[model samples]
Target: MPLKYLTADQSRAARGLLNWSRVRLAARSNLGEATISDFENGHRIPSPRKLAAMRQAFERAGVVFTAGGPTLSNRSAGEGGVIGTQ
Candidate 1:
């Protein structure tokens, strides 16, 4: 399945939904404050570690990240099943 990357706005919204302050996120994810600001402001791509940290933070806030595409499990039927659905 093709990966549907999140737009900067969406990313920022997700971060906001997780209630992560820029400083707190930077500290927890080991990212610089300016880097986090740029990412939130659509000026930069977050590093892998920062992405992972964002995912973890969202998880802690009960926000699930779902890919917007088909998965191997659902490829045969073309059903709109989630990638990691049990």
Candidate 2:
């Protein structure tokens, strides 16, 4: 299913699953690190376009976003389980 929306906690969980720093995600998503940090910290929500770019970057790196949270793609599943929100 397509992701209808992404939560700040979910974004942080995805980053933890991927072992990605804000700088790396920002670089991959073509966004600024400050933007990512702000979003993850719940200070601001990104525009749809920027959020799409972040999701695409994580998906390309084998992370899958689900209704429950972020999980590894089947291709990378051996590494770990789902990263769920609190």
Candidate 3:
């Protein structure tokens, strides 16, 4: 099955919840920082592999994405996780 990619908002939220930077996520996912930055900035959509890599990276770090928003596992990740990474 095709994996559901996280929205730009959710991606940003997950990063905040993990207190991670774009470089951090890119390093962890073995993807380029530009890829993550572009996706999160709504400049581009990542391929399945890149999306899966990013999601897996966040998941391993205890982030969970929901219809409502992204949250840290077993903890409340506050709303308005929107940050200006543009």
Per-residue accuracy of model 2 over 1-86 as CA lDDT, tens digit each? 14645667777877887789999999999999999999998899899888888877776776655555445545544343354433
Candidate 3 residue lDDT tens string, 32-62: 9999999988899988888888887877776
Which residue pairs clash within candidate 3? none
Higher lDDT: candidate 2 or 3?
2
Worst lDDT 10-window in candidate 1: 77-86
Query: What is the per-residue lDDT of model 1 for residues 1-86, given as tens digits with 9 covering 90 to 100?
Result: 11233335544555564456878766765667787789778787876656666545444444444644312233233222222211
Clashes of 2: 0
The prediction achieving the highest TM-score against the true structure is 2
- Judged by lDDT relative to the true structure, which candidate is superior, 1 or 2? 2
> Ranking under lDDT, best-scoring first?
2, 3, 1
lDDT of 3: 0.71
Residue 63 local lDDT, model 3: 65
**Per-prediction TM-score, please?**
0.52, 0.77, 0.74
Q: Model 2, stretches more than 4 Å misplaced?
A: 1-4, 69-86
When 2 and 3 are scored with TM-score, the better candidate is 2
lDDT for 81 in candidate 2 is 38
